[model samples]
Each structure stands twice: as structure tokens, then as C-alpha cells.
Target: MNLRANERLSERIMPRPHRRFIFSTLLLCTWLFIAGCAVDQKAEVDLYRRVLDGRVAATQPYVEGESLTLVRAMTLANQHNEQLGLRGEDYLQSLIAKNRAVANFLPTVSFQPSFTIEQRARDGAPSGSTGSNTTASGGSYQDSGKISYRTEAPIVGSMNLFRGGGDIANLQSADANIERQRLLLLDAQSTILLNVAQVYLQVLRSERAVEVLRNSVSLQEARLKDVKDQFANQLATKLAVAQTQAQVNGTRATLLQAQSDVRNGRHTLALLVGVDTINGKLSEQSVTDAVSDPKHTLTDYEQMALDRREDFAAARAAVVSARAQVDAAFAQYYPSVSLNVAGFLYREFYADASKWNAVLLANVPIFSAGVIEADVRSAWSRLRQAMLNESFVRRQVLNDVRTAFENLDAADRKTAEFEQQVQAAKEALDQARAAFANQLAINLDVLVAQDQVLNSELQLTGVRFDRAVFLLDLTRAIGVLPEVTMQAATRPATLPGLP
Candidate 1:
């Protein structure tokens, strides 16, 4: 009885040991799961931190006292503009294509390793496995089964010896594509520069207009004050005071409009220069002095544009690229040749060996449903279109040069005439003011003279602004703008009141 009791106690103890092992295993698994979660959470936090840092960097403010000029604006636009970035990506792709085309002439190498298992059946006499003749001698026979395994590792290489010049033509086409992208980038730069110039000039013009109108308003205010004093002394009528106040109000309204224009221009310039704000003052005198007569003749400008224009160069590159495409298409008419080499190691249930092999292959083009011929025709059509486009661009360049030249000449003559008008109007206003003070002229005549003087000054400002714009346009048409240094100037703390 004691032996049986001890045996039952040992069994119970063994079962308790198994339970403890199970509990420990579950606890360990739970700890591992928690640890994995903690690791993943840590990684997520790091990623979020990096993203937040990038956001902070992108939102950083521009530096103070950063002067914006034509060249600086162009550089900034090129660096930040999405369109330029896209073109740069395209250029990179073209370079990759060129490299790929060159690689076609180099050999390609690869490796393949594989394992195979097979089962086969054989006819034999029981365990002895005698031949069929033994079975015919009245011996018992049965079918036997066997399993086998095989492994093979191979290194293979191939190279194209000839592709009827298609590879060469493709390489040439890639080169042309690269050239086209470069010229396109240059064209984009020129266009951005011109746009920046336009906005810059507009800002200067609006600011100057504001200044002129402020002066006019001040003069009108003074005149109104004088009229009010005369009326108090019974020397001038209340009607004169009312008219002078009306003139002041009108000038103030115009000044407000000009100030609005200045703000809008600055906003546009900020966007172009990739800055949050534009802070520096534009040099009006420097800009006016930069607008001079073109030193070259119209014919010379036309020739220069033809030679230096990016669009013209891009058109030529397109023509060459199209011709290469034509060649690539024609290459399909001929046969291709290639060479292959392979080294292999093979193993089976009964045998293991290694071997090397070389092969030369030739592929001759057979009858296809006019696919190759169709491609040739399409390529030729594109080539023709490219040539025609080049011609059209040439004609367009000529027209632009001549038109810009004519407009610039007209602007020069108009500017000279307006200068003379401004001088005469100032003299006439002086005489009118003197006569009014002496009581030889009426208040109406003096007011008309003041209006004429203001009008003449405003008209002169417009003419000068137009002349500066025309000069820029003419230089752009000639495919070369005179470089102007960005002069450093202090920003004014305050502008004059608009109302």
C-alpha cells in the first residue's frame, strides 16, 4: 500500500511541473509582445520628429536687408520654380537613357540555381530486380519505385554583337534630347528674367507716381488754404475755396490708386523672388539711365537672335533627334546578331558534373504586317514636322526683332516731345500763378493752369516708364539683355499718405 501511495504522489508532482512550465512560457511570450510594441512606438516617434524638423526648416523666414535685383530674381526663380525642377528631372532621365543605350553594347550576366526532386518506376523481379528475360523464364516479377534529386547552378552571359546600327542611333537620339532640355532650361531662365524685370519696373513706376501725386496734393492743399484766407479777408469768393478743395480731393484719390498698385507690384515681385516680402527700394534713376538706344542695327539684332535664342537652338536639336528616330526605325529592316556564354554545374542521383558552352545567334527579320514600315513612315513624318517648326521659329524671331526696334524708336521720339511739353507747362503754370496773384487772371484760369501742369507731369512720367519698358523688350528680342548691377539702397521707414 505504501508503494502505491508513493507512485500516485510522483504522478501528481509531474503534472504540477508541467503546469509551471506552461505558465512560464506564456509569461515570456507576453513580455516579448510588449517589447516589440515599445520598439515600434519609438520608431514612429523618431519619424514624426524628422518630419516636424523639415517643416520648421521650410517655414524659416528670409534674411533681413536682402536686396532683390533682376539677376538675383532670375536665380531664385530658377532654383525654386516647379517648372524648372521638372525640366531638370527630365534632363536627368535623358542622361540615364543615354547611359542605358551605351550599356546595350556591354554584356549582361546572370546566375540561376535550382533544385529538383523526381520519382520513377522500374520493372524488376522482386528484391533481386532481374531482367525481363528472367521473368520470361517463369520467375516472379514486380515493379519497383525510386526517388531521385537533382541540383543545378548556372552562370549565363550574353552580348549583342550587332543590331543593324539601332543602338548607335538610340545613343545619338539621347544626346539630342539632352541638348534640347538644356536649351529649354535656358529659355525658361530668359523668360523668368523678363517677367521679373516687368514687375520690378512696375513697382518703380507706381512708387514714383505716388510721389508725384503727393506733391500735387500738397500744392492743392496750399492753394486751398490761400483761397480760404482771401475769402476771410473778402478778397476771394467761397466758390474759389470750394474748387480748390475739390482739386485736392481728386489728387488724393489718384494717389490712393497709385499706392494700391505699388502694393500689388511688390506682392508679385515677392512671389517671383521666392521671398516672403520685398523690402528694398528700387532705384528709379538707375533704371532710367539704363534705358539707352540700341547700339546695333535691326538686321544685326535679327542675326544675333537667330544665333543666340534658346528656342531656335532647341528647334534644331529636335530636328536632329527626329532624324535619329528615323534611323532607329530603318534599322529594323536588317538582321541582328548576338553571342551567349554559360557555365553550368549539374548533379543527379547517379552523376555530378560541370560544363561550359558558347553560342552565336542570328535573327533575320521575316514578314511582319507592315509594322516596321509603318514606324519608318511615322519617324519620317516627325522629322518633316521638326524641320517646318524650325523654319517657323526663324521667321518669328525676325518679326519680333523688327517690331521691337520700331516700337523703341517711336518711344524715344515721344519721350523727347513729352520732355519739351513738361518744360513749357511748368513755365505756363508759373505765369498763371503770378497773374492770379496780381489780380490779372481769374481763379478759374489759375486752376486750369495747375491742372495742365499736373497732367503734363503725369504724362511725362508715363512716357519715361514706357520708354524703359520698351528698351527692355527690345533687348529681350535681341536675345541679350544688358546686365545691370543691383544697387544697394535703404528702405524708407514710411511712405507719404495716400488720402
Candidate 2:
């Protein structure tokens, strides 16, 4: 019953018709402002599509199941890798930050219209007293208290006229952060390309291993058949047949493991390329046929890395951002200034009432209980940390160059050794076959030498694969993966409102 009574009371106090018009005007102004400033999702998506088309390489044929080439695999990874896409968001947000800093220089305007009703007892009146008080609008009430109305419809605005150069420092800091994010995005693209290439080579290596193992199995089966024929003619013992069958079984097991490695390697490559599975054959030409010596010395590679590495450039940008933050923090020791203005749309008629008014505000900071000092110290520490990180990144870049160069060098040396070993095994196999034809060597000797030759060839293939992968690694370590894979480096990303 009391709730019903309150509802009836509220209905009786519905806004006056003139006040409703004022409310509608405020609503319309707010809607217009929001509509003008809001981000359009469709436009943003279109922008993304256009920019992405120019940046990423096309891999339509590869995605539709063309055989997996390393170059195509890299193209697919650049288009579809989830982590690389996530890194792109950082670059996008940095552009938003750039716009936000730009907006700090603009004025903030709003419509602030109020229609307040006050119902209170008279001054010094007892609690729950029924006495009335004169209202602001000159009204008298006798129910439980006085009733009054106060209304205002004003357009207000404010702008930061000055802030001890802090605004300028903040804008500079934001610009530096933008450049840093762009460089990091480039680094991410290079990283993904190198990863895809590594996995692609892994699949190639496993496929080659499987091929070598299959060849070994075929040779072993041929020998087994020959031994069975000898046993049937009473020229070989049953124990000899059993021994030959055991060797064939062992070779089959090794062949199965090699086949499994091929499948597993392909699966990994598929995931890196963002595909559900990869069951196609890799190009045989992907194998390294001949390896050459390093084209540059270790010192030369190190210098290239230091000059071309994107993460190092990003680290240097971080130091600049930190220094700007320090300057902004110190600016708190100076004064700030701003301007505020208001124009009344619904003004009360009075002899001294003004249509509009403006006030200039200035704040001089004399003391802050050490708050400003603490901020300065924090900024200085961050600046120091950024400087140290830049130095550390430089060291790491050199280290990466040296490590990759050394690994490639060692792999090249092993290629020579493995080639010699393969040649010697082939020579031994030839001599053994000749001796067997002359009945001077046993059949088992000839078969054993042939197996040695095949094994040596397999080892040589593995060394060549290693050399190829390490060469790509050296290219990546020197920060040239983008140049080699995509034929161009990723450019700085930009968006709407970016300067």
C-alpha cells in the first residue's frame, strides 16, 4: 500500500513541459557528439584488409595444397600465424595512443543541464517536522517540508593552456613508443619466417632419412633371398638362414622408425604453417646439393646484426621514451595553466545575471610532501633500466651472430669429412664385389661392404641437410630473413589519426 502511494506521488511530480524540451535538447547534443567520435568497426575492418594485402605475401596456391616449398610455407605463416597476428595488435594500439596524445591539446566541451528538486524541513526544524521553508523559486509548502526547484542548462568547455611542457613531453614519449612498436612488429615477422623455414627443413630431412632406410631394407631382403636359395641347395646351414632373417627384421624396424620421423616432422610443419595437417611430398630440390664457405667473417656478421636487428632498435627507442617520461615527471615542479568557459542556455532573470563567463586557471606547485621527488626518482630509475636493456640487447645480438656463424662453419667442415667417408666406403664396396666374383671373398663380405657404403651415403645426406638448415639460421641471426624470404622488410604500421 505505501509503495503504491509513493508511485502516485512521483507521477504527480512529472517534469514540466518546458523542462522536457531542455532534456531532449541535451540528449540530442550528447548523441551527436558520441556518433561523431565513435570508431566504425566496418571501416576499421576494411582498413585492416587493405593494409594486410600490401604487407603479407600471397600464398593461395600453397594453401590450396601445392607441395610444401619453404618459401610458400613462409608465406602461409606470415598470413595465418596466430602469434604474429597478436603482435600486430600491439602496433595498432600504439597508434591509438598516438592519437590520444594528440587529443590532449584540444578542448573538451560538454552540455551539463540539471533540473534538481529539493524537499527539506525548515532551518533548525526538528526531525520529521511539518514546518515549511521558503524555496529558491519562491514556493510555500505545508505537507512535511519545503519544496524547491533549481534548473540550469549550460554549455561548458575547458582547454589546457599550459602544463610546464609536460604535455609536449608526453606527446614525444608516445611518438617514440609508436616507433618502438613498429620495429618490434618487424622483429616478430622475421621470427615467424625463420621458424617456418626451420620446420620445413626438418620435414625435408626426415623424408630423406626415410628414403635411405627404405633402400637399406630392399638390399637386406635381396640378401635374405640369396641365403635361402643357398640353404635349399645344401650350400648354407639352417643357422645361417636364421641369422640373415634376424638382420632383415632389424632393418625393417629401423625403416619403420624413419617413416615415423617423417610423419612427425610433417605434423610439426603443418602446425607452424597454420594448417590442420600436411601429407604432401616436399620438393627434392630443397636439399642442399653443395655447401660453400661463409661469405663473411664472424666480425662482419656481428656488425651486420648490430646494425640490422630490429629488437635492438626498439630497445633504443625505449630509452628515448624513458628520458621523455623523466622530463615529464620533473615538469611537476613548475606551474600549469588552463581555461574554462560556460554559456547559459536557460538563465535565471536577475539584474546581475551574465550570459557567459570565462576563467583562466593557474596552479603553482610549492610543495607535495615529497610526491614530486618520488616521481622523479621513479622516472630516473626507469630511464636507467632502459639504457641497461639497450646495452644488453646489443650484447645478445652479437652473441646470436657468432653462434650461428660458428655452427654453420662446423657443419661445412663435417660435410667435407662425410664426403670422404662415403667415397672410401664406395671404394671398399667395389673391391669386395670384385673379390667375390673371383671367389676370393665370401658373399657375406660383399654384402657387409655394400651396407657400409649405403650407411655412409645416408650420413652424408644428413650432414648436407644440417649444413642447409644452419645456413638459413645464419641468415636469420644476421636479421636478413625478411630480405631472403619475403624479398622486403616489413614497413612501419600506421592507422587512422596517426601523424
Candidate 3:
């Protein structure tokens, strides 16, 4: 009895037609909400998974106990540098933009489904008639209530018929942007390689300086001992023993500084190569051997730089993209035509129907408060800016090529001069030591000779390293650094002077 009473009460509150319409609408809304939540949850899960994977990868150990050669260093820098990775991501984004440009030529389709329930009331009673005579006369009579339900499902599609070649222009612009990004990536690679070479050479130079200072310290210690023994025999004065001891102390200090430099240089090199520590011994002789004489004239190198430099190329591509933007802006002047097709389904208390329609639309802009004109002007201005940038970059490239060539030439000359000085200093030191042992020269003369030898050796080491570094700079200025292959475990490529 209670169930029957409840059923009657529910029917009175909501008639059958109204209840059905409400139920259907609620069901559709619930399903759509659930589907949207599922999609969002799935995206969240995938994002978390990627984050976890990145954390694991970051924790993985890098290669250890491997020789860090110049080529290997460059390879690792290219693979692991954050800046290069960002450049790659930019390139990928440009590709996505290109895809979007292509999609503009395809038809767009969308669906809109709706359900509505409405309660309406109407009065049928004349304006001047009495209550019972209102229906008899040509006047409004009684009031009646009506409930209506409406349902519609329309699938609409539209395709562009004509847009004054704007779509084509946009696609071309996207292509130009992609090319620009590629050139930028190449530029970054060259820069990173040059940096690696510089730090690697520095490490070698510091290590060599330490070795030379160590030898000098050992020689000074022997000389100090000799002077002390002569003093015991009263053949050498106390002043001579003290002078020798001072020379030994100075040599030891210089050695300590050189050792410090080696440590700092190695740390910097390891950072550049994206490793925990740099593990290989850098060969000073190998670095000197790798210095090659410049084969081309400055003019030739300048030409090469202009041709191969990625910055110049990217600038040119930017101009092309800007020009495309101008063309796209001009397309707004012409009429745009598109074809649209739509279908609908409706159900109600008084009507049930289905309908389909197709439309051809052409929109021609007659006035726009100068909006289109301003866009064209803005695009043209950017194109002009790009052109000016291209000119500036060309001049800069030429200047860089000439400057690097001159520096390399100067380095070569200095290296040769230092080599001669080193030989002369060695001869002077040998003669001075012999004379001092024979008591024909003072201990001060031996110390002076030793100082000359050390200075000459330090100068020679500096010039040799400078020569190698200048050569690298020359190659980088010419935009022709040797390419290193990126791989899981990269092998060193053939450097300019390496077999």
C-alpha cells in the first residue's frame, strides 16, 4: 500500500512525458561528464609516468674510466647539454606548427546535441467580453497549460572553397620557420664543440706546466744540497747556501700553483663534457701535433663562413617567413568562400522531425577600421627588419673569419720564436752550471740561468697551447667544425690532424 501511494504521488508531481525527458537529459550529461574525467585522469597518469622515467634516467651513472678526447667531449656535450635539448624541442614545436598549417586545408566537423523541457501557459479570453460569453464571442476564453520537449542532434561540417591563397602562404611560412630552427640547432652544435676544445686544451696546458715545474724543483733541491756541502768544506760562503735555498723555495711555490691550475682546469672540462670527472691524460705533444696550418686565404674562409654559418641562414629564412606573412595579410582583401552542411533531429510532445541543410557562404570585408591595413604594414616592417639583420650578420661573419685567421698566424709566429728561446735557454743553463761547479762563476750566475730556462719553458708551453686553441677558433669561425655522431656510447671522430 505504501509503494502504490508513493507511485501515485510521483506521477502527480511529474507527468510521464516530463519524467522521461528529464531522465534522458540527466543520463546523457552524466555519461559525458564521466568520459571527460576519464580522459583527464589518463593524461595525468601518463604525465606522472614520464616524470618518473626522467628521474630514473637522471640517476643512472655516466661512463667512467674512459678517455675524454676532444671528439668524445664534443659528442657528449651535444647529447647532454640542456641548451641543445631546448633547441631540439623548438624544432619539434615548429614541426607541430607545420602540421597545423596543413590541417587548415582539411574540412572541420563538429556535433552539437541538446535536449530541453519547457512548461507554457496560454489564455483564451477576449479583451472586452464577459466570462461565459468570451468563448462564444471572438475573444479569448480560458487558460490552459502545456508541456513541451525538444531534442536535436546536428552534425555540421565546413570546407574552405577559396581564401585568396592564404592557406598556401601560411603553409610556406611554417616550412620557413622549420628551416630556421634547423639552422639554429646547427649553430648551437658548433658553439658547444668549440667550447669543449678550448677547455680540453687548457687542461693539457696546465698538466704540462706542472710537469715542467716538478723537474725544476728537483734540480733546485740538488743545487741547494751541493751549496750546503761546499759550505761545510768552507769552499762556498753562507750567502751562497742561503741563495740556493731561496731558489728552491720559489720553484716549489710555482709548482704548487701549477698543480692547482690543473685541478681547476679538469673540473671545468668535466662540466663541459657533462661528466662527473674527466678521466684521461691530455697529451701536450698530441695537441701541438693537431695544430694544422690554415689552407685557405682569409677571403676564401670568409666566403665559407657566409655559406655555412647557420645564423646567417636562419636570418634569411626569417625574411622569407615574414614575406609570407605579408602575403597572408593581403589575402584578407579578397572574399572568402566556404561550404557548410548541417543535419538535425528533433523530438517533442507535438512534433517529431529530422532535417538537413547545406549552405555556401562568401564573406567580403568592405570596412574594418584599418585593421587589415595595419596588419599588412606590421608584416612588411618585420620583413624589412629581417633583411637588415641579414646584412649585419653577413658583415659580422666576414669580420670574424679575418680576425681568427690573423690570430692563428700570430700564434704560429710566437710558437716558433718561443721554440728558439727554449733552445737558447737550455744551452745557457748548461754552461752556467758547469762554470759554477768549476768555481769560475758565482752561485748567483747559476740561479739567473735557471730562471731564464724556467721562463722560456713556460712561454713555450703557453704559445703551443695558444696555437692549438687559435686553430680551433679559426675552424669555428669558418663554421666547419668536424661533426661528431651522437650515439649511446660515442667514439671519437677524426680530428683535423688526427689519424
Candidate 4:
């Protein structure tokens, strides 16, 4: 009976300890699950921030169709162009150069005046005439005291009669340089505008692509479920499910890459317009409107490029400047004449000493060891080089026109071809699904048809975007731009739509 009582006590103790152990185990698992969920949330936030960093925010809110325009982009580019506007230093330099040129035509005037008091010895040499001499007395001194005052004032003037034409050539060169700088500023503005447009288009395209891929992933997931169901029923092979899964994963990877590109494109556009945005999604753009207005044909582009391209004009200007330099270099070998004159006013202790003095002098270039000859040769060579470069650039511009025209044509054709493909694939997909419903087609065939449709849709979207990009490139290459109307640059295209 004592043994039986001990056994009962052991059983009671065992049940309490076992229950406590099970409760502790359950608590630990709950804590681990909560900790894992927190880590996943933190990771998602980081990804969001990274994506936000790449995108440009709209400066102001507007609908996609009306927010930004090409004319507006040009305006913003010009307004924000760092080099176009005149600065204090630029004005100062221009004035200095102008003054130097004007000085060649005007007389320089300056004043020289002075006053003094002096004592002269009786012997007629102005001096203190101090000397110690022995006298009849032990210590006697003799000193001379005579005071006089005198002053003289002079005004000087000078003008260059000739510097063989160096001064004139220099003035002409300065004017040419100023004009060149102006053209350069315009060219820079054009370049910036083009960059803004391209980046903006890229962002828009990327965003749209992301959206399409998201939809594609959903479709892929749904198809995956159907394939798994078929496999479970032994009507579809395992290999079919695996193929669908692979396509889904591949598409997901593509989606990720598209998102990354969209982010980077947005960042570039943001910096161009000087926006300071972070941690916010970029707004979508309607690139269709911006790119829809292209009107120039290949021939038109060639003609316009030859006439309107800023680089071509700048090249011609450079050639002219180089020729001017040659002339200036040759002119250095000739003589130059300058005149100098001076006048003095009265300023003296004595009235007779106060009078005006004037003088005139001429200067000329004498000689330098073959320096002028070398300069002329160098200038002539540069002129030749400039001319050659101008020709080369013209040819390059022509080539670009041809290439852009070809690309534009190809893009147009591809858009049409892909659209047709998408239509055909859609019909095929429908037929496959109907056949499967009637038991005449397998699930695998339907899945294949769906993939083909998705691929065709993706290709068509890509082709559309390519056509738009080509349009932009052609516009830029032809040096044609619509007037910019906005106060800021635009964001890039959003992602493309997927199947």
C-alpha cells in the first residue's frame, strides 16, 4: 500500500513538469515568428527607400496628359542653363576688352605736379654751404641763408597712329569670340534639353514596364496554379508546371531590373531640373504627346541640319576666327606708330618757374627674330584645320540623319509587326483554352498558347517604346525642337505594360 501511494505521487509530479515544458516551447516559437516578421518589414522599407531615391518628383501636380510638354522642357533648359546668362565677371571682361580697343582711338590724359622749398648758396649752386673755418676768435661760425620755391605741373596724352592693323584685328577677334560664346551657350542649352527628354522618356517607359510585368506575374501565378492542378489530376506532366514556374521567375527578375532602371532614370531627370526629392514615388508622364509631333522627313532633316545645326554654325565661325588670326599674325610684321603729348601747369614758390610743358612722340615695331613669320604659319595651319574639321562634322551630321531615319522607319515597322503578332497570339490562346474546355486540347497546350500571347504583348509594348525613343532621337539629330513652355524639366517614362 505504501509503494502504491509513492507511485501515485510520482505520476502527479510528472504531469505538472511536462505541462510547464510544453508551455515554454510554445512561447519561444511565438517570439521567433514575431521577430522574423519584423525583419521582413524592415527589409521592405529599405527597398522602398532605394527605389524612391532613383525617381524624380514632379515640381507641381498635373495630370499625365497635361503635366509637361516639349516646349516646356526647352524653356526650362534655357532658363536653367548655367552658361547662357551673363555674369558680373563676363561683363567686366567684355568692358575691359572694349576699353582696350577704344583706347587705340582716344588720347590718354594724366597729370604731373609738384611743389618744393629750397635754399641756395650765394655761389649759385643751391646748397646749405656749411663749412667750419678757423677765425681770429677761438670759436666763430659763418652760415649762408637763402630760400627759394619752385613748382612744375604737366599733363600727358597719347594715341596710336598704326599697329599695322593689329588693334583692329584684335577687336574683330574679340567680337568673334563673343559671338562664338553665344552660340556655344545655345548649343549647351540644346544638349541639356535633349538629355532631359531622353531621361524622362526612360523613366516613363520603365514605370510602365514595371506595371506590365506585375500584371504578367499575376497571370503567370494563375497559370501556375492551373498547371499544378492539372499535374495533381495526372492530366499534365510535372515538366509543364516547372516550365511555367521558370517563366514566372524569369519575368519576376525582369520586373526587378525594370524597377531599378526606372529609379535611376528618375534620379537623372531630377538632378537635371534641380529638384531635391527623396522617399517619394515619381509621377507618370505622357510621352506620347511629346513625341507625337515629329514632322520632318529624312531629306528635311538633312537640309535642316546643314542650315540650322548650332555646331555647324559654330564650326564655320571658328574657321572665320582662325583666318582673322592669320591676318593679325601677318600684321605683326608691319610698323606701328603712336603719339604722346604732355602739358604742365604752374606750381612754384617763384612765379617764373610755374609754366606748362607739352611734348609728342611716335613709336613703331622694329624687329623680332622670325616670330611673326612663325605666328602667321601657325595661324594659317589652324585655319586649314578648322576648315577640315567643319567638313568632317558636316559629313557626320549627314550620316546621323540617315541613320536616324533608318531607325525611325525600322521602329515603325516593328510596331506594326508586333501588333499583328499580339493579335495572332491572342487568337491562338483563345482557341487553346476552348479546346481544353472541350477536352480536345491538353492543359500544356493552353499554357504554351498563353505564354506566346504574353510574349507577343511584351514585344509589342517594347516596340512602341522603341518607336517613341527613335522619334526623339531623330528630332534631336535634326536639331528640331518644339518650343519649351514649362518652368521645369520633365521626368522620364514610367514602366511599360506587360501581358
Top of the candidates by lDDT: 2
Candidate 4: TM-score?
0.70
Each prediction's whole-model lDDT (CA): 0.70, 0.74, 0.73, 0.62
Q: Name the regions of candidate 3 deviating beyond 4 angstroms.
A: 1-62, 117-147, 238-242, 283-294, 345-354, 484-499
Q: Candidate 1 vs candidate 2: which has greater lDDT?
A: 2
TM-score of each: 0.75, 0.84, 0.78, 0.70
All candidates: CA RMSD (Å): 12.9, 6.2, 7.6, 28.8
Model 2 residue pairs with clashes: none
Which scores greater on TM-score, model 1 or model 3? 3
Residue 55, candidate 1: alpha-carbon lDDT: 17
Question: Could you give me the TM-score of model 1 versus the true structure?
Answer: 0.75
If both were scored by TM-score, which would come out higher, candidate 1 or candidate 2?
2
Better of 1 and 4 by lDDT: 1
Q: On a 0 to 100 scale, what is the lDDT of residue 337 in model 1?
A: 99
Error of 1 at 281 (Å): 2.4
Where model 1 places Cα greater than 4 Å from the true spot, the runs are 1-62, 115-150, 285-294, 345-354, 482-499
Ten-residue stretch with the least lDDT total in model 3? 132-141
Best by TM-score: 2
Runs in model 2 with CA error above 4 Å?
1-15, 33-38, 41-56, 61-64, 120-146, 237-243, 285-294, 350-352, 437-439, 488-499
By lDDT: ranked, best first: 2, 3, 1, 4
